[model samples]
Target: MSIQVGDRVPEVTLKRLREGLETIDTYTLFDGRKVVLFAVPGAFTPTCSARHLPGYVEHFNDFRSRGIEVFCMAVNDPFVMQAWAKTQSVPDGLQMLSDGNGEFTRALGLEMDASSSGMGIRSRRFALYVEDGIVRASFIEEPGQFEVSSAEYVLEHLPG
Candidate 1:
């Protein structure tokens, strides 16, 4: 089943480009912290670049002020994730996570077959509000939909 509110995130490794390529586990990343984790099918896509990603970027401080960390994930490699970060002028506060092999995405039951679009296996658009490794809320979008998983929606729901 796909993850839900109150579910513990699956233990899996994801890549991020910091000073260099750094490997991080979902277990560690969400441990003892309030995190807003958002996922997209792929990075650099139209909707993703135009609104999804930028929404998070623009709301970095909104999350931070609430003591939450923001994470953006995609089914792309670390290199592409890093490049998109730069392309979007993402700051240091928002982390770009890469589910390179889609293992993490599959583990969370959020993988989508995008082979017809030449995107191969990808992540469904979703966001999770996690605290101390347990989900506080989960906003998963329907296929080809962008109605629920935006930063504005997450912000509206975060504990004040």
Candidate 2:
């Protein structure tokens, strides 16, 4: 089933690139914190790289100012994600998480197969406001849609 607002995030270990190799789990990463986790189709796609990811990057400070940690996730390897993060100049505070095998995406029921587009398994565009590993809010884009998952939308939904 698709993850919902009140559901606990599934436990999973994901690789994250740091000075050296590092690992993190869903619960540990988000437990006891309000996190804004947004997923895109792939790491370096056109609209994703130019608009989706950049929107979050541009608003990283704003999100943090509201006490929400921002994370960008995609079904690409950590190495590719690291390169993309550098290319986009992603600040240290804005995390780039690699769901390389799509395990996390699939566990959340957000997996999308884009083999027709030669992208393989990817994630549908969505954003979630998670607190202590439970989803507080979820914004899912309709097929071929983008507005709802934008950073501005997530910002507007932040609990006052």
Candidate 3:
């Protein structure tokens, strides 16, 4: 089963390119934090580029003002994620993370097989609202669809 509300985020390391390639574990990233982690199937894809990431970027401050940290994750390498971040003009505080090996995605039962598209294994489109490492809400999109996982939907449905 995929991760559900009240589930603790799995322990796994995710890569982020900052001053250097940084390896951060899920615990360190999520513990004691209210985080909105939205994952895409790949970096630089059409829907993800035009709508998914940009929506979060446009609403970054709204989340932050609510004391929530936002993170964008994909099944691409750290280099590609960093490049995509720059191209998207992502805010400094909106983290771009790489689940290059799909470890975390699989651990959450959220990995999708995109081998038909030559993308190999990827994360399903989803947004997770986590508080202090426990999931408070989860919005998972259907394959080939983009609705529930959008930033606006997640923001509107965040638990009070």
Question: Best lDDT goes to which candidate?
Answer: 3
How many clashes in each candidate?
0, 0, 0
Q: Candidate 2 on 90-150: residue-level lDDT in tens? A: 9998888989888999999998879999989999999999988999899988777899899
Residue runs of model 2 more than 4 Å from their true location after superposition: none
For candidate 2, give the lDDT of residue 64. 92
The lDDT of each candidate is 0.93, 0.90, 0.97
List candidate 3 stretches off by more than 4 Å: none
- Looking at model 2, residue 55 earns an lDDT score of 92
After superposition, candidate 1 runs with Cα above 4 Å error: none
lDDT per residue as tens, model 3, 32-98: 9999999999889999999999999999999999999999999999999999999999999999999
Q: With candidate 3 superimposed using the best TM-score fit, by how many Å does residue 133's alpha carbon deviate from the native? A: 0.1
Provide the RMSD of all predictions against the true structure, rounded to 1 decimal: 0.9, 0.9, 0.5
TM-score ranking from best to worst?
A: 3, 1, 2
What local lDDT does model 3 show for residue 63?
A: 99
Q: lDDT tens string, model 1, 1-160?
A: 8987778999999999989999999888999999999999999999999999999999889889888999999999999999999999898979899999999999889999999999999999999999999988889999999978999998997765
